[model samples]
Target: MDIIGFLKSQFLCHLFISYVFIGTGLIINLIQLFTLPLWPLNKQLYRKINCRLAYCVSSQLVMLLEWWSGTDCTLYTDLTNYSKYGKENAIVILNHNFEIDFLCGWNFCERFGLLGSSKVLAKKELSYVPVIGWMWYFLEIVFCKRKWEEDRKTVVQGLQNLRDYPEHFWFLIHCEGTRFTEKKHEISMQVAEAKGLPKLKYHLLPRTKGFAVTVQSLRNVSKKFYTEGRRSMSAVYDSTLNFRNNENPTLLGVLNGKKYHADLYVRRIPLEEIPEDDQECAQWLHKLYQEKDSFQEEYYKTGTYPGTAIVPARRPWTLLNWLFWASLLSYPLCKGLANMISSGSYLTLTVFALLMVIVSVGVRRMIGVTEIDRGSTYGNNENKKKQP
Candidate 1:
């Protein structure tokens, strides 16, 4: 390996990266905390401010995937839809397959200038996690408990509040609700068979109630969200992403300077086409997942999706943001290191070593959140029987 690549593999370099992320992230979180009062004064202005603040924390991960790992995200979309990507509001539907799938999506968000205001329907458990999760609270990210009875009321209320959102944003949803594993797939297919639905090879049966409710909440709003002539959400960006060479990408692999080629296929279906009734909407979502499976299967066979490939350019914002934080934090970090070394006590050294171990475990735990083996068992036979 070359000098830069070798350095990327070093624990010292990893420590520097983690230190910068946590340090800058906590500072951003503090800033977000100050914005809480602004919400009561001017909600729109507060959201705008939080959007930019959230960008600082999220774009660091984008930098790691795009700049450090040199991953390229190729957009397989029509030119017309591509023109409308960052200019309008929409609901984004994505498959939860690989660990780095969300990173790939964020890279697109950065490329198309949607990084700051982008949002997602994430699990409620994530709301309690530090840094990113704290950042999400300020971003107006919708969190669900994965229990329909408990979530139905609150989820609708949460989404309805976005009707008057100032800026254009893509509210992303992982319709499958959890990362795909072979066991989950098997169970999902069993549910499909029990329900008399067609078996899907590349995906799990989509949890439809969430998608149905989201569509219902956002549809046919008589009130105009943007008075300055900006549009409210009017379409669905049905996206399917796959990595070239069948590579199972990971956050750890990206951190270690591995490169990947990601191809994303997005279809801009008008919101009007989706059925309004809950049961019909469920059918529509299942059909959509079936189509997504076909696209994945086709890509595996032909090495491409169903449209012309348009390579999205990497934005410099993520890189620039990282550099700003690194430069600003370096002097204080170096000073602390020097002071610790000057003390030169065995206890201090032992404490430092223990801190390193803690940091290592913390990172692994964070990454474990996306691991298939460590994923939720929300799709088991018992849960399947409870499916509506």
Candidate 2:
């Protein structure tokens, strides 16, 4: 193994990287806060700058996935449609089966040059997390409390504002609504059977309301949601992602330099083809997920997505971006530690070490949230009201 790669895999190196990520991220958040006044001066310009700023912090994790851990991301799709990926806005509906799936999605966005500006329909709690969450606030990422009654107006207005987004973005939706687990899947399948819907072998029952809200009215809910002049999504990218058979990669696994292969199968459907009625739209999503389940089954059998694989070369910029941050931040950290040690201040060193331990704990907790096995059980409750 390469010495540097081995060094990066070490626990101390991971700690340093985490420190730099959180520290620089907090600084970036401050800079983002200062830009709030500029929004009134030139909203488009403010947004454009925030996109790049967000990219600076977000891409660190992307680099960790793509470069540090050396995860391979393969895109499976027609060669003809490949040219359009980063050029237009898209709604990406992906299976929620893995802990690091969102990072994988970010990797794709990074490859296509959209990491900074990409959006997601994330849980409301994420909007308050330290670095990543605060950055999403500036990126116009929509957050939902998972209660449609409370989220409908907020979600609609957020979607409406995307009509004037300054850059091309891919809005991601984990339509299964929660990550997959055997227990959750069992409950989800029960709901599927209860509703007389087809059982999904590899995924949870999709919460239809998010997709339903996108295309049409949520009957008996918010009829006004399908507004005049509401911006249409450019297209729907039905994305099915899977790790190589027998490999289940986690965020912790990636940080530990466990390389894994990811295959993403994408099928783009035009906006006009999706039905405008809520019920029809729900049906469409259900059928799409069923097809996705079949793809997963075939993948486990064949070890690849069902198409010609188009794996993009990992770009130097992600590595360069990460190195830039490390160089910019590490010198002061090392120098301060050296000074403290040389001065023989045991108290200062002890306090600093304790602080580092605290930061590490926080980072570990952040990683914990991304693990699907430990993920929030949003859609598994049998008694909870079903979404449209």
Q: State which candidate has the highest lDDT.
A: 1
Clashing residue pairs for model 1: none
Number of the predicted model whose TM-score against the real structure is largest: 1
**lDDT agreement of model 2 with the native:** 0.83
TM-score of each: 0.95, 0.93
The per-residue C-alpha lDDT of model 1 at residue 345 equals 83
| Candidate 1 positional error at 384, Å | 8.4
Model 1 ranges off by over 4 Å: 223-231, 381-388
Q: CA lDDT of 142 in candidate 2?
A: 86
* lDDT score at residue 335, model 2, on the 0-100 scale: 88
Q: Report the lDDT tens digits of candidate 2 across residue range 164-235.
A: 667788888888877888888888887889999999999888888888775442111222433532234568
Candidates in order have lDDT scores of 0.86, 0.83
Please state the error at residue 170 of candidate 2 in Å.
0.5
